[model samples]
Target: MPSAAGTLDWLPLADHLDLVAAPVASAAALVPRARVARIDAGLADTAAFCAAYDVAPGASANCVVVAGRRGGATTYAAVLVLATTRADVNGVVRTELDARKCSFAAHDDAVGLTGMEFGGITPVGLPEGWPVLVDEAVVAAGDVVVGSGLRSSKLLLPAADLLRLPGARALALSRPA
Candidate 1:
């Protein structure tokens, strides 16, 4: 673990956490003693991050933001998938959100809501009422690498505990990528 006074420049995960809402502290307060890792490599892509970090495919989780549209308004919901698969976003998310149209939010749009850079956003500190869909594969993984509320770090936690966050819900709603 880096020191409390460690430098966060070039560290998206660490820098964002320090600048954004109390995401890390909130997790610790709720889950008790959670530790986040600051990695030197970019975790922007599931495949690349796993290969660079030597993390097994089954151990990685892909966090995605999907735009939910009803009439002319759009809202965003989060979907968590096993890195080995893609979120069945079109099928499950559209239906779940009651959206007439749905698609992935642009990188900039996602970062705005998350206050974290791309590849490192987590559902932990998102606005309440934004649904979080967790693929069953992630639930069964036991542990996962989720965003540290920042772009350069990852929160390592038991998968079950991730579901305890305010809006997290485990669902069997993704297909192999």
Candidate 2:
């Protein structure tokens, strides 16, 4: 990892599966360039993590789970956007999912469905077939910090690498908030 990567001693994400959620560990192992590091659970949120770690907001991304429901069918997807902005959830995201209404997934629903902690859910390792809506700016960012599916750890990798995961699509997904 680069020395500019704040204070975290990033190492191969695959070697520290125990520090991440189960699904993250499984999917991360395939991304050879990805790295992981431990952090105080209290600093898991984007603002705290960036402040304490000296990471730029532009270099940090947040993953949010959104639910789109129409009739009795519901679709879930993960949205990734730079911390400097916010996902256009009610606009682009809802249209992207092709649902009549959309909103942030309920806390219990997000955690239970993904098997990841509330503040640590990541776009990586999501259930199969769920689209990972990555903001265009995020993919263009060379290096970015992301959740590890565990509040105690974080993932570091080229933001573009996120596109390698299944069902990833680069779009104008966010705007300054």
Candidate 3:
């Protein structure tokens, strides 16, 4: 297991359920290697969290919700990219989701549909059938910090482990920020 750096005290997620969101807590069984750390909710946003925790921006990953529409059907997906890059939402993502249009999901829709806070929507417990589009760079990053489905906590684990999550797919899905 990777050790936590900076000022945070990381604890096994299974033993620290109260710090995470309901969905993340319920999914703890699926993440034996992950550790969770409580943080000031006010710093949950990526940039603030990284700076406050003394973490490198490239070693943090962000999960974004995308809404893709084609005809009368709409599809939702999770797009994960390193903090140093941005998801190719209009090009790669639209093509991958097989939608005529794709963009970041509305804030309310993302929170309502995923049952997670706007800035803390991790990919671990996403709804079934929602594709998890992981950027290849994220997969290559051995260990990284990610949201814990709540603004008050964060998750730390080997990036490669994300592939075990349901609907996960590795692809070149990001461009430089």
Candidate 4:
């Protein structure tokens, strides 16, 4: 596939991915079809990544980790939303998680739990039992781009394929920015 930087060497998601992102590769394999591409690690953040790679914002998905507490127990979830919108962390997400209050997970915690870089967490390789709450719009966006758990690559797959991930579920979890 071609990108702003020239031709993108799209490969199976399982190949040429970092070992830390193995879970993402494993989950991606479960999908009927998935592809990945290497990119400059410095451009891993959404805006830079899209611009540097010639990807439309709408075609890029961002996965954010949220955390909250209820009944003295902490709960966490990975929320997937398009770059064009913002995840409703305090509203729909909190309600869905049955949390009294919710907020984006701290940098260290998110990286520690998922073993993914700060700007490269993806729903594909989240901790077991953590909900992968995808915004409804994301699933309807056709094939979308997402982080590869490491900052060195990104995955491309149908939005619906994300919903098929082990703990993934679609919800009205985002609002336009």
Candidate 5:
């Protein structure tokens, strides 16, 4: 598989990610040419990771978990937006989730539910009931880098493949950062 640089040793995502994320990553890998790269956990955050690896910020994606509540019922979603944009949680996302209010998921709740570290949450391994809301811009970026469910690795795959994952839906769900 093609990689950003020889610095990233491309490998099957299932081989490098945590148990909770492995199966999903493995499934995503079935898309032709998908690749994953192991990196320092300390650099998992988008800005640092992109800079350290010489990756363009515009080509990297961020997955953020959000929670919404309505009539005492809570709903969760995973939003995928390019690094250059921010998910429209208060507007588009709230409407899509049919919730009265929406906000980023709490760190503890996110980690506990996803079984992944704070900085490495990705849509690939999310719970079955949660929706994966992907920004239309992400799909147009071609190959993009995303979290691997562990702070120590990142998945690199075509944005088109991401849109194909189960529960994924594309929308104009982002605004400039």
Candidate 6:
């Protein structure tokens, strides 16, 4: 239950939901029941997350932030993909952001924008302004793990809930990486 800041305070996902300004509905609103657990290891990096959580690479989902141009202005969006495959940021995400140039947002920027610590970031509970791009593979999955509005824990929810997250669905935004 330790935090990235090395604080002793630890709260469960259920407890932190009240602290979030966004929605707190269950994954059943979109998909079926799935297992949820609290993680104690640091998920600051993909390899570390997978190893610490014992998450199968093929069964895991990765959420990333992509910066691009939208409506002739620079913008950023979150993209979700299976851990087994990389996000197609430069291809579809570039066009989605409507930018001639696009790339991953800086680490600090991504964490600040999403309001969640790195490695624990999921498509859900993001600020309203940021769009979410979901890979089709994720949607096909029955269940997935996402952020619980905190960095120390993750929620196992239906992939369909990912679609329910604001701006989560946008066709052709993903491709084999």
- Per-candidate TM-scores read 0.82, 0.96, 0.96, 0.91, 0.89, 0.74
lDDT values for all models:
0.70, 0.89, 0.90, 0.83, 0.81, 0.63
Off by over 4 Å in 1: 1-27, 41-44
Candidate 2, residues 85-140, lDDT tens digits: the string is 99999999999999999999999999999999999999889999999999999998
Tens digit of per-residue lDDT, candidate 3, span 18-106: 88889888877877899999899999998889889887788899999999999999999999999999999999999999999999999
Q: Give the alpha carbon lDDT tens digit for every residue of 65-125 in model 6.
A: 8889655677888888876677777888887777888898899988777666767766665
Query: What are the per-residue Cα lDDT tens digits for candidate 1 across 1-177?
Result: 222212322233332345333645454555443446556645446566666666666776778899989988998988998777888777888898899889999989988877766777787777667888888889898767666666556666567877887778888888888
Worst 10 residues of 6 by lDDT: 1-10
TM-score of the candidate numbered 2? 0.96
Give the lowest summed-lDDT range of ten residues in model 4. 1-10
Using alpha carbons, what is the TM-score of model 6?
0.74
What is candidate 1's CA lDDT for residue 142?
A: 77
Backbone clash total for model 2 is 0
Candidate 5 lDDT by residue in tens digits, 1-177: 223342576776545544325545555644545677778889889888887888878888899999999998999899999999999999999999999999999999898887677898887767777898999999998888888778888878888888777789999999999
**RMSD of each candidate relative to the true structure:** 5.8, 1.9, 2.1, 2.5, 2.9, 6.4
Q: How many residue pairs in model 1 have overlapping backbones?
A: 6
- Report the lDDT of model 6 for residue 9: 30
Locate the minimum summed-lDDT window of 10 residues in model 5.
Answer: 14-23
Ranked candidates, highest lDDT first: 3, 2, 4, 5, 1, 6
Query: Which candidate should be chosen as best, given lDDT against the real structure?
Result: 3
